[model samples]
Target: MTTHPLLQALLPLVDDLSRELAEDERYRRLLGTLRALIPCDATALLRLDGEQLIPLAVDGLSPDTLGRRFAIAEHPRFAALLAQRTPTRFAADSELPDPYDGLVEEHVGHLEVHDCLGCPLFIDDRPWGLLTLDSLVPGSFAQNDLDNLEAFARLAAAAVKANQRLLGLARQAEAEQQLAARFREVAGQAGRAELIGQSAAHKRLLAEIDTVAGSDLTVLIEGETGVGKELVAQAIHARSPRARKLLVSINCAALPDQLVESELFGHVRGAFTGASGERSGKFELADGGTLLLDEVGELPLAVQAKLLRVLQSGQLQRLGSDREHRVDVRILAATNRDLAEEVRAGRFRADLYHRLSVYPLVVPPLRERGRDVLLLAGHFLEQSRARLHLRGLRLGGEAQAALLAHDWPGNVRELEHLLGRAALKALARQAERPRILSLEACDLDLAGTAAAAASSVVVAAEPPSAPLNGDLRQALDAYQRQLIQAALTRNADNWAATARELGVDRANLHRLAVRLGLK
Candidate 1:
């Protein structure tokens, strides 16, 4: 292993630092110190959520992945680690598929990192996450380096706990601020006309919302993530007579289980440790407006019952109050999951389901939303350029085509992030001339000839948004993954040879294969 000065200084501090990982305030500095010690170009902390590894803390990496997920089945190497439940090493010539291929070229541009070691952080024999280190050079780690890696990984386990708590607090603060800002934006605009969409489906959705928006009907807006369900709810509230009142929306899935109820219903003084004064529940604050319960499917069963009571009756009792408070709030619920299945599974109340779905409106995914992707992408690009002052920048025809071709599993949210990165790169390009956005700039590796071909041309005019047809996306992805895996298995996981024949990134091929469950 190549040893550096930073490691020499940090080696003595491992045990001490590992102990301090439990300290919340020192979390970042702890990760920062380890990042410096490893001298990696980028270091990331992944926390296990069910069977997925979610990137939580990142240093010297793209912020686009502050909360990105990598499913356990997505990568063979990662799967192998999970299966064996042990630390493993993978070099450029390892037997497993490389997980970082497409992601590296399109985002980090790190071509090196030949020697990689990963260790699972276990709390009570359950995997928490893995600590990853990447250097700018290949073949950098040796067997002797395993000790330090394990030490750091253990420390990362504790750091993950501290980090999650810190992040939870940070999220609460940010939610309050953003919610305040949003409420301010739409205040006193109730009973106003809604800016309904021109499309048939959208118009119908708006009509349904309008009928309920005025009646304090608990609405359920169902759709895939990033499909503008929140926007639909906002339109409902804005057009309703409740425009003069507060519209409170919160993502039920985003909040930790322990804090969901507390966050929704305000606490009384001395209710808990942090309750220094009385606070108001969202229902009370949105008394005359609407409370959008985003991702309502994710609500814990314990909390779901309470939410149901609030939806049924127009009254709610705060955390510490025995006195029931009546509120004139309208409820608008949204979810990306199949609540029908949830209801069947007894995870959600059937009564609540029936009540909220009184005005169920589904928003189409970007790929199925005919021309909306481009409209939204263009809108996002404009927003990016306007916010960043990125001048003389345009998406190339190839990039547009690639954007159109993408399944957009992340939906509109993903497009916004891609445009933001592309805009940043366009700024770098403006030193010479008008910067044309391409798949590369968008941070899409544009793997496969289809992707590259789609991205290479110049677009003459603005194109239609939401061009794709349907859920055949999952089928297509499955087919492609099947082909790639067949070839890799035939070649015994020889990615370089496979890439040579298929003519794509050996890395990306692996990553895609992993995503497809082919790996």
Candidate 2:
């Protein structure tokens, strides 16, 4: 006896759903089969995380849609879907706005989605996530279509259950090896007061920190420069049982290579030329507490070997001393460089990298933190007002837009400095003591800097052909002249500001302007 065609097709899909394949590949194949089974313009598999639906696999949505997190409370269609267990279909003319409006990959400049079908997947009688099918044509799905989708949803649920079990087992093993009861105690503590932000990225970071704070595993905090790597270290120390003990910090990059060893581990008298008296290093001072190695990627090879020995046995000897002393300390390292790549490049040791990165925590960049930018800006504004003894300070609408639009390469530190500079600029221009000091877009100076950087790239990429046909020196001079002129215009003809924006000294800028016939 032969089975039905739909059942035959599903047999192979279930067989291929094994632990050997990657989870993302499994989701892609599952969504692909659903698309073939039920003809639709788009299909998406979303995982429910708290109140947000994170796109796991999207077949026909824009690339950016996968990066977006849809909040259930904000979208009526998602709320309606979650309200019931049965497959829910929305009418083409339904007043409720679609969560994925203007997000279809094929339909550019169009926001309306004609037909939508969504089904919630359940595991062990609990809601797990949703499987959605969308069509550009109105009234595309019929009653029978809903039945077919509901069948597919059952298979998807089973696959998700299997995947979750596998993941849970792996997590169990890792937790057993890396964590202890201390982690649970620290997990419940309110996070450090200095690290502020309520975005999803921020919350996720805090959660990761809390989970690992109780453990003695070495943690490597990685992120871009000025992304608050130090703040993360402080949070870990504050949450740990070692909070009462000292938290000693050392910046590897700040000290010379010859002195890095003495700074990290104590040195005895007569160890080096400058060793006047025996001194206790950061590691010794931080005994029974935590030690933070900031910019640890800059450690020399010789020091890295000694550091690895101490990490392994918790025993270290002072320079020029044979006696070894045992210390109890938790190691926390932070860096902006990719240590794995550094290890591969021969600049860092692989063994030390493995020793330090038992648990790695990443701090999210400022641009990815969403509306947290506004919150941080407001915080910085208040700080500036307090420091300057101003009556009041606030960002104008245009200034807020500029802050949101700019891609902050320097992260939180950059934002704070920019806000401080803008506040001072605004106060300088104010003739009277106003009730509220307002910072305008011009005061921020971000628009000019952003435009200048963008235009410089464009100008560099394609120079004028007419001028290039002349003397090579003249064409070079002309290009230089154009760049300076643009910077001058952006800075409103202020020579010092123009020089600063162009990254040249005021005297050098004046000399260049004269040589280029712009003086």
User: Which candidate has the top score in lDDT?
Assistant: 2
Over 1-519, each residue of candidate 2 has an lDDT whose tens digit, in order, gives 989877875775688666556677888888888888888888999877557676778898654355455668766788888788989999899888766654555554344578999999988897878999998789998998898888888999998778767667345433432332343244343223357676789999988987998888899999877899998988787767786676788999899998998898889999999799998888899899899999998899999999999999999998878989899999999988778867876879999999999998989989899867876776676557557755345666677788887777568988888888888888888797654576789999985554443344223233443544565445556666677777677779887678667654354456457756888
Residue 516 shift from truth in candidate 2, angstroms: 30
Candidate 1 per-residue lDDT, tens place, 1-519, comes to 888764674654454444434332354555577656555555666666555665655565433334234557655666766665556777767755444432232234433345566777886566766766655456776665566667666666655555456546435434444544455565644222223223456556656765676666667787766677888788777656666567788888788897788778877887877889998877777777778898888788888788778777767888877888888777888887677866876778887789778867777667665544655654455446446533222454467677767777556776777677666755565555432232342444434433433222212212323344445545455445545555566678876556555655333455456666766
Give the least accurate 10-residue stretch of model 2, judged by summed lDDT.
453-462
Q: What lDDT is reached at residue 427 by model 1?
A: 58
lDDT of each: 0.61, 0.77
The predictions' CA RMSDs to the true structure, in order, are: 23.0, 13.5
TM match of model 1 to true structure: 0.49
